[model samples]
Target: MPDTRQPVAARRTHCPYCALQCGTRISGTRADAVTVEPADFPVNRGRLCQKGWTAPGLLAAPDRLAAPLVRGRSGRLLTATWDSALQAAAEGLARVRDAHGADALAVFGGGGLTNEKAYLLGKFARLALGTSNIDYNGRFCMSSAAAAGNAAFGLDRGLPFPVTDLSRARTVLLAGANVAETMPPLMQHLHQARLVVVDPRRSATAHRAALHLQPAPGTDLALALGMLHVVITEGRLDTAYIGRRTTGFEALAGRAAGWWPERTEAVTGVPAADLRTAVDLLTQSGDCYVLTGRGVEQHRQGTATAAAFINLALALGLPGTPSGGYGCLTGQGNGQGGREHGQKSDQLPGYRSLSDPADRAHVARVWRVPVGRLPGPGLRAYELLDALGEEQGPRALLVMGSNPVVSAPHAARITARLAALDFLVVADFVPSDTARLADVVLPVTQWAEEEGTMTNLEGRVLRRRALLDPPPPVRSDLHVLHGIAVRLGEPPEHYPTEPRKVFEELAAASEGGRADYSGITYDRLDAGESLFWPCPATPDPHPGTPRLFLDRFAHPDGRARFADVEHDGPAEDTGAAYPVHATTGRVLTHYQSGAQTRRVPELAAVAPEAFVEVHPDTAARSGLADGDLARVVSARGGMTARVRLDPTLRPDTVFVPFHFSGDGRANLFTHPALDPLSGMPEFKVSAVRLEPLPE
Candidate 1:
């Protein structure tokens, strides 16, 4: 008889849900039901969301792809052996490279990957495949904010400080972020600050705020400019700090001169009085913080909006101060780290620009390849996909850890272009919407069965420990990527077998660059110590930086540049055919696309169906009631979902959470127009028509 005293089954591990990256302790095995409990980590302090607690159920879900799958002659997926799958992938990639050159293949990565896996994927794409047409889902998530921050402050680390620091702030201006729903635990800190939420609708975060300014979508820049105008006119600006620590004050002040409250009020729909009050509160507070999220960054004017927001922070001397600054609230779990490690179209590891000769030389030395072997930055995501259908299109693609069919913009066009590829390979734990379209799908270990690090919104790099063994026939993503690189004849120096060694090499590649991580190692991380990046060599014994730009800015002049920005409308405006401004976002019950959370029965039960949120007045006008099926159509695409009249939403606006699949792909209706500077698609505001579905 089996020992009854022993645990009934094998131990489980943490959930691979959101950027919250909550620690979960799993105990049980496939023979029995698995149990998951929150671990007492400093980040969450044993707090677990419904998604985290129910994550283990997904491991044994019936629909999980337990083995390799490959498309057959009939265009349907068939089970295949690991060797056969890998060989096919290698041959297909090699054929594409030989026939069409390296640029003919594109690789798409995800923000959910382990740092080791992310690093190796970039290495494989550039070194092994010799392709520059590489980008990631992060291109949609945080690239615009990063571009804005890099241009204005010379650095972008999301929050640039810990989330815990928010509790120390006297006032917090949450512009466009919906933290209460996307990251509920973070709301605990917001309660301490006098919260001010700015959005087109009274979102949950806005309802909780002391002041909620409901401006029209895409008019955030005007609201920010107006606030700056009030602050400056009232002599509330931090003149001493601006005189010493910042540049471009004269140009910025001149730009704000024309954006008086009355003028901005007419443009943004925010009351002039409210704008003045917001400015007064911001200036009176000892410590104030300004934060922006996807609502502001996923737009054509994203970079400019971010710059304008930063200008307000700079005008008040908030940045580089304790518990006060301008922060971009990144969405993905590894969104901060993913961009920092050269996953973007125009960057190298260490957040270095590909055009920088010294950065190129340093990374080339680390990879042990000639500087010429590393191509300059490639096209962004939308451009990469668009190139797939062009005469000089990519013949093959290797996608890892992302579901672009559901997540990417212009879904119909992107799907058609993907189908045109000569070869497609996807490496993931489950059969995602994108994987289902691949020529070959390789099974990989999930978060609970993997070991690595993930940097959170606050730039805090924390360890993600593997607590259980992966299922049979499954391997780590890093291992799978390394094997592919080796099979493709990458240089021996770049063919490191160990994940830790690869991370060390990645750290070395980041040395003396903007997102510097040279001073860190796997050893230090394994010791339960964590810190932010730019951890350069120091004389003391500390490991990494927790807060950046405390005494000096990263710019050569040690001064932050204030961007003079003007308001711009969204790409698509609400009109007769498309009468509602459709917005997409996350929900408390689910994470992006619901690839993991949907597997959990409990989490699925909590949010079983997709629904479009419309105001009661609009729903009535459209002859629809709550729970009624509503057909929503935009210029790009259309979908049908159950309707829920939200009192908080403005009459002309609709909201949809981007967690469902099939016809419920919210991105299907999103506009593909991108920010000129960052190439981030505008997912927040799309013109859409809502009508009651036929009975």
Candidate 2:
């Protein structure tokens, strides 16, 4: 093991990938000459994932953008000064708004943005651009879980307790989350627990489980319902806790009453005996946890699926205690914070509703603007992207911190919509696939060159200290936003370029809402205080809330509500024509879109490109062999990948990592069917067919 002792002059910060946000220290003054060592953080202790250890490579990547680029009259991107690029972007956006309407301008954001950046981007879209069309890629990440958590508990903070609390759990139920690969450091907390994994693929996490329930794709809802049915039938309901701390138990029980093990097994493809075993492990526990990830929450009924699991947790009386609870394994680094601030289409800072009169009034006062000037809620991420350049949609767009070209569902469709736009601007440190399509690409500072605060999956806000200065001609996203706001007729004071000032404004804006951060200051964070949120300021230096709902749920009556959720199968079902299910996820070596990790030679050499995970039985049935190039075609599009046979995977299911670009992009085949409540696109399961491609 490497020495973890703090080196003199080393800057303390957090990882740039994943919500673990493992504490890290960099010990060099230059971007390319830095070495990263793990710090003693509560979440990951002193361990860092491969992606976190090799993150500095992103700073010195050979393809790092050095200067702004603008499309000239010849329709080609050429080097341009910051002044000219900002001018072109501002004027183009203004032209669209003047010709069509304020709604003709849109902004797309990402989950990786800092709290300050997320706050300012939402403010810029509303007060500066005077448009309501703003949403981030987090809608695609965990909106379903957010919606369900809000409905059931009246609040959502990913995990309601510090990640360290999981170490004492006797039973840990990981539904659709592969923590062993996605977040290896997190496995430290689960080693003492009796693990139960639910996934179609025998992921690395599943392999470690005492019991693995391999249900068919899109049947997670049914599996959860089956577990609840067993719990109720076996008389394991926590009646005292339920009567005291919950409502709607009878309705929820009635909904699950019909889903006996046999019926559930027929739909979910899990044996009735195995379902009973899962229930036994969960109920016999001293402390238990139920956590859901993207696998179950990316379906058309994503919200309902999450609520079903929440019902199970409540029935078991697991939540609201110090020992165990229900939570969502948030994917992105700032996914929890990005959506809490004003980045989501229907939200304002503090997780306030956009259409709420009181929420509008409070935020308007914070911005020093009239409440009447605040536009109503706009379209969600997929809706906004699908409507790009259409007569009824925004003609111009500004994208920051996301690469939708390879990440969005139905890539072919999103690509066409992007091409149809009148003007496009992308702010990024690297020439990502999305940046190559922009009318103006503004080179921006990366994680190591910027200082800000990011709230991790556990809801702890950590300070990100800059280790080195950015290269010449490259600017920070805050500076770029301030420039554009000034060019578009907003005062410089309204849009501060400094991260501290922006955070101060954010604190005020989020002072009274659900995910309040008013009491959290840079002083407390920099002083190494562990601050989880809903930390209100007016309460006279209140201690930060590391554990939530210890006494009561975040509801008016202080009782959790059990959702009457039911199982609705996949949006698209398998048939003779398309008889297989295809799923997408991340590999250990890469993250969303492969924007940074792919640049690291060490990571790329380990998992250089995308490949399809096929069971040997399925391969032989399709007349394909291992290492053969095959085309996986769905109703929307097709992507080619090398076939790797894995006997552990379900025979009817094929898995592909959604990190590569071009013909290897997994999202090309992902269906755009959205959950009615959360607007989360169905990314977990799609009906697809496989065809052999000759070498």
Best candidate according to TM-score: 2
Q: Cα deviation in Å at residue 313, candidate 1?
A: 0.9
- What lDDT does candidate 2 reach at residue 309? 93
Per-residue C-alpha lDDT of model 2 across residues 225-339, encoded as one tens digit per residue: 9999999999988889899999999988998999999999999999999999999999896789999999979999999999999999999998998768999999999999999
Clashing pairs in 2: none
Count of residue pairs whose backbone atoms collide, per candidate = 2, 0
lDDT of each: 0.82, 0.93
Winning candidate number (lDDT): 2
What TM-score goes with each of the models? 0.96, 0.98
Q: lDDT tens string, model 1, 183-204?
A: 7767777777888899887778
Distance (Å) between predicted and true CA of 345, model 2? Answer: 0.2
